[model samples]
Target: MLKKAILLIVLLNGLSPIWGQKYELKSIIFEGNNEISTSRLKGVTLSKESPMWFLQFLNSFSGLGAEAIYFDSSKILFDLAALEEYYRNYGYFEARFSYRYELDTSNFNANLIYTIIEGERSRFRSTFFYGLEGIPDQTYASLIQDYFNASNDWYNQATLEQNINNTINILLNSGYLNARFDSTIIFRDTSANSADLNIYISKGNRITVDTVIINKKGEGASLVNEELLRKITGIEQGSYYNQEEVKRSQIRLFRTGLFNSVIIIPEQNEVSANNVNLNLDGNIGYMHELSPEIIVNNQQSAFNIGLGANFIKKNFFGEARKLTLSTSFGIQDIFNVDFDNLIKRFSFRDTTLLGYVDARATIEQPFLFGKPIFGTWENYATIRKQKDYNITYYGSKITFEFELPKYTFVNFLSTYYNIEQTKEVYRTNNDSLASKLVSTIGVDLGKSTT
Candidate 1:
């Protein structure tokens, strides 16, 4: 028993060094870590205590299956520096990290070390072009200089591709339809800390118009007016066919209101410069007029009632301006109800009153400003009451109206008045005559549809 007890004491003494040498990573607090957090670093630990913990930690480290020691950090400071570098490789150039460390000999405690460092950033400093012989040099000068000075700008693969596409479009619109640009863009660091770009352009061929054909399809096939067709074509056989002008022609024909639908197509021919065959497909429709209207008014409120009919032409000078001519007749009664009341209150209501009824015939010829202005006018006269108790009055006014800018209208009016007076209402009378001239101005707040 004494021998066994001595052996047991020796064994316990031997095991004391392994158990007492504690290595407890109590906390792995980090600092200077802008992109990564403390929790994430703590999660990377292989051990949290000592003795038996170290054995499990060794096993965990072995299970990492790393081909090299690139991820291992025995010291907290080393781990933070490694983590920062890892973030930099992923384009987090401004990333940093640090740690704190603590040692307690009596309790066997472990603390972390803090570290900080900046990361690597990959950005664009400038963009340029080369091997563009035919294009004007000034075209790219401004764009390249601007992109280079943008320091915070990153390298974008799509932007480079779109730039090439836009360059090709410019060439195509300038009569170089066969132009092409290289797919590859070369990026070089001309300066140690800056990136420079160079793009190559290929100007293939300069083409001109070889021939142009204006074809109209549909019926009244025989009734299709040649004069109108010629005006609509707007392109000659020997002239260069402008793509933009061809599109405008399509819109123009649609606005004419003569066709239900119009389409202009440019077909390429097997010529040196491409020949354009314009195929116009449309349905021709005849012009017609419909006029039916209703109006309501209160005469005491100076209101008028009117109804009319007219004919209209849709396109004037191919600019979608409407031309209209119409004849309208209306009855207007103007009176002041307040005036009658006031006269009654003043004891003048018994005085004899004179009222008039006016009838007129009008002819309107609406036109654009640059055209001649001419219209017809006439008037009729009738008497309702007399003012001098024995006097009866009649009058007529004739006027010619002209239009300017579709908003303002002007007219010249001439009036003739005849009055007859007698001692009694039923007696024969003596007459007097008066004539006057007046100019009138009118504004059309609502545009005339017809």
Candidate 2:
């Protein structure tokens, strides 16, 4: 029996008016279901009650809530059949399903009620695996004892299917590139209310990489070299095939932001015995962009409006590097300020019409020293005038980030250093000026599963 079934229900919110139907399905209730929850049983059927009464009440005023479901006698048989099929998949082989409805003619609402007879559930009597030979003995044992341990539990098709996929992943990560799930057979004994499960898998010869072909598309492809992409992939000739590493490589390449699309295709058709060729295809987009925008901000409890522009150059210099430059200017307290002399007051020394001025430049390198580490450098300058203080600042920072392989205590690591100079002047005391230089260095390490 299939574990998951996609049930599509066509809602006829508009059909009631045409057919002059009066009863809207107000509630769906289940009774005598000892093993399965009512919510789960409802999820498997096409029949659904309308939204809650409060939601329907709110819908009358705002027109945004779950729509009403009119009673459809024609769908009762299909709903019951779906319920029976779901029960069988849950190992309730002798289950029975029946439904009744209560109609409130005065209110023009109907309540659907289902009765379930959950008979004896079948348990797994024995389970067997075939065709997982030639892999490590411990791996086979772990798959049996840990991954697919289905002891004393009712026969659940979904759990069995999920375990099969997990076992296949273990095989693929262990270099069995051609590993695949074949089929599962279940023998049910109605008299004993038990089942024997047989799962078959084909783990073909463990494969190694014979060669990797780098395929590029779009105009910006030449800006990044094949060597950098190959290093990013970490898949080399004569290396054992690992699906996890292949996925990680794809993620690394994508994190560069140089390519719009990336795909690592295993050339299994070109396999020779235990060796196969892989293809890494990347599609690049336009590498240069000049964007301008309007910035609205709340600074010092005042609403401010600004204009900004950014120029970005992708694949700058080489090796999938990126360069960005941006600048913005905004005025303070426009409601209380005079714009008649705005151009005359636009001076660094004049604080009358000044809000803030900020400019920044950044460069990003995908990798450093032929390693997985990523590096970034940024420099910025700013000037601001508020109700009490006026300030000017300039700063620069460099950061390096990288991710460790799996099974490590810390998977992500970052280190950065920043130095800045700031000068501030107070409005009340003209001579009260402060200037300082600050520096900081730190490291961050964390384990990430996403």
**Largest TM-score belongs to which candidate?**
2
The TM-score of candidate 2 is 0.75
* lDDT tens digits, residue span 1-450, model 2: 233332221234434453575689888899999998988988987988887778878787887775677888788998999998898888988898888998776688888888988989998778788997677887777577633467768778787777788788888887899889999888888899998888899999988888778999987887778887887777778887999888888887887878889999888645378887889899987899899999888877877888999998987877778899999999767787767887877654555675889999999987788777789999999988876788999999999998687756888899999999999988778748999999999899999885
User: What is residue 117's positional error in candidate 2, in angstroms?
Assistant: 3.2
Assess each prediction's global lDDT (C-alpha) against the native.
0.48, 0.83
- Each candidate's TM vs. the true structure? 0.37, 0.75
> Could you give candidate 1's per-residue lDDT for residues 237-267 as a string of tens digits?
6454445455556655565555667777655
* Per-residue lDDT of 44 in model 2: 82
lDDT of candidate model 1 versus the reference? 0.48
- What does candidate 1 score on TM? 0.37
* Stretches of candidate 2 exceeding 4 Å from the true structure: 1-29, 46-77, 91-114, 119-127, 137-156, 187-196, 269-273, 297-303, 334-349, 405-412, 429-431, 435-450
Please state the error at residue 382 of candidate 1 in Å.
23
